[model samples]
Target: MRIFAIGDIHGGLRALIQLLNKMEVKDEDTLIFMGDYVDGWSESAQVVQFLMELSQKINCIFIKGNHDVWCEEWLRTGEVNPTWYMHGGKETMESYEHFSNEDKKKHLEFFETMKLYYLDDENRLFLHAGFTSMHGVEKEVFSNTFYYDRTLWEMALSMDNGIKTDSVIYPNRLKHYNEIYIGHTPTINYKSYLPMNAVNVWNIDTGAAFFGKLSGMNIETKEVFQSDDLPSLYPNESGRNR
Candidate 1:
């Protein structure tokens, strides 16, 4: 069975569907979504609904993201966060206007049930953002760190090529897994619109919430599949670029 890790969807349902179609995934394949499934494009609720149905037919591991935390809280309390509203929550809120109370409950459950991080039998680690504990993710003190940390990717990016896993100077976090997959920080910020690799860490978030495409990568082969730029699909919408 093949294993694929998908980057943040950010409400880009069209892009998400396009990326999935490009992958030609089978039921036997395992798809690990790196999170931020809502907020950004015009279809935040639709994206979640699609994923809810999609999971029933295939192996899907959903990782909760920081944005998802904001959305989840809003769904549960009806209290909108100012920061979340500024960032893509406005779009996400609008997308749910047509959803019934029952639908909202189910989606809320979907968000609540998502994993903070996932570890496979092969020692591969997947999380929405990053973690801080040098001892490894299991030792992380803050659950929010799983979806909000950037230091993990930054540490990986600044890692020296010459430092071996056996070296005392090596980051302890890197030594815990065969490979680490993450989203949150967009690769576009670094000027690349593709999944990036630094040492053993892979940043799959290709900035689908901004101007870049939604991406999916075969973890075993490192084969990439991407959708058209989100703006291209939703021409009238600014898609968080605003």
Candidate 2:
């Protein structure tokens, strides 16, 4: 069976569907979604709904992202913080307007059930954002760090040749896993629109929430599949400015 890890979708339902169709996923294939499933484009509600249905058909793992935390707050208490709204939460809120109370509850339940990070049997780590350190990554103290940190990627980016022998900074950073897959910090920031690899860490979030493609990487083979540039799918929208 094939194992795939998908990056931040950010409400790009059209792109998500396109990529999924391209993958031609089989029932036994496992799909690990590296969060930020809402808050971009115009279809946040639809994206969540589609994933809910998709989970029933296949082995699916969902990670929670910062945007997802904001989404959960909005759904649970109707709180609309400006910071959250500014970063695509406005679009997400609008997407839920037509939903019935039960439907909202279903979506909320799905969001609440999402994990901060997932570690497979093969020793690969899948998370929305980076971790502070490899030590205690599986523990509860690192739960928020799993979705909120970016230092790991920064270190990966700044390191030469992606290999670190000195364990002074982060003792187990390089030896902890076979590979690490993350989203949140888009690859566009690196001036590339494709999934990027620095040593064993892979940043798959291709900025679908910000004029880039939605990406899916084969975990075993590291092959990539991507959708069209997201803005091209919706000409009128500017996407997330921040």
Candidate 3:
């Protein structure tokens, strides 16, 4: 049984479908999604609907993202967030037009039920963004840290490669997990189109919101799977490029 951690979807349902097809997931396999299921392309509602159905068929863990927070709020209260609207939220809002109020309610429940973070049996940590507490996720102070923090990844990137795990200067946060997986900060921003590792922290987000493709990584084998770049699949759409 394989265990895979999927990156941010960002409404690229076509890319997502292609990547999943390439992965050829099995019934016994477990999927851990790193969130940001909406916001970017034109199929936000469709992506949510697919994930909801997918979860019902297999073992799946969904992590909530900041973009998801905005989308969920809009679905629940019909109040649009200005920042979200500016950043692909308009497309997300518009995508729901064909759906009934009942469908919207079901989608809202899916989002509401998502976890902020997930810790696997192996002690690996999966979260949308980062956590600041040196003591680990359980000690996180900010309610939004799970989906909004970047310092954890930043610290990992800047950490000296020569520092041994047992060294006194090693980050206390890194010691709490066997491995840490995250997806908020796209690896494409760093010019890497594949999963990137800075120490034990692995970033699976390959920038599907823009020019990159949907990505998924097998946590056990470190194997990566990705779709064609989002632009290629949806040539007519800008997909949050502006």
Candidate 4:
């Protein structure tokens, strides 16, 4: 079966739809979404609904990103970190103007049910964020780490900051795996994949939330497809960190 892996959507439902339209994916094809489905754009709720519906029509593997984790926590505790709010949570909250308490609860439940990582029989690993362990243990995967260990979160943050090297600490020891697909880190170019190191880890985040293009990569072919009208939201590229 052909597998198409998509990057962090961040509520860019229109871009996603456009990309899917262009792909002309077959029913037998598998679609793996790397997560960060909510926040950043104006249609977080719509994106979630679309994904929920799409999950039924195709073989879909949904992994949770950092933004999704914050979404879950906010729903459960009614508390959110300031950094998360600044990043994209505010826009997500704004998307659900008419949502009822029941609707909110259901959405949170959906987030809770999302897998933090996915591993295929082909040994391909898909995660919203990178891993922390060097042993290639299943428990080291984000699915288990996020729920059980805070150190994993810290490692992700450190990697982002360039304070730590992922290659050194968690060498791509899963040599048996064909590739590890990840999101969360926006690429300078949204239409292509970015490599974190010499490892076969692919970062497909097209930064659609920032008006950049949405992207999809065919795992077998490494072919990329992008949505039209997707351009860098910020001309200077300075606002991306915001």
**Candidate 4 lDDT by residue in tens digits, 1-242:** 78998988887777788889989988898999988888776778888888878878888888888888888888889897798888888888877777887888988888988887788888888877666666664646445453233333334334533323335554344443667777666664434334232245676776666656778889888888887534343243322245
Give the clash count for model 1. 0
Model 1 agreement with the true structure over 1-242: per-residue lDDT tens digits: 99999999999999999998999989999999999999999999999999999999999999999999999999999999999999999999999999999999999999999999999999999999999898999999989999999999999889887788899899887889999999999999999999999999999999999999999999999999999988899999999998
Alpha-carbon shift of residue 15 in model 2 (angstroms): 0.2
Q: Which ten residues in a row have the lowest lDDT in candidate 4?
A: 231-240
Q: lDDT: which candidate is best?
A: 1
lDDT by residue (tens digit), candidate 2, 15-52:
99999999998999999999999998889999999999
Ranked by lDDT, the better of candidates 1 and 3 is 1
TM for every model, in the order presented, reads 0.99, 0.95, 0.99, 0.79
Off by over 4 Å in 4: 137-176, 189-198, 229-242
lDDT of 3 by residue, 1-100 (tens): 9999999999999998999899999899999999999999999999999999998899999999999999999999999899999999999988998999
Error of 4 at 83 (Å): 1.6
lDDT of candidates 1 onward, in order: 0.95, 0.88, 0.95, 0.71
What global local distance difference test value does model 1 have?
0.95
Ranking by lDDT: 1, 3, 2, 4
**Model 3 spans > 4 angstroms off:** none
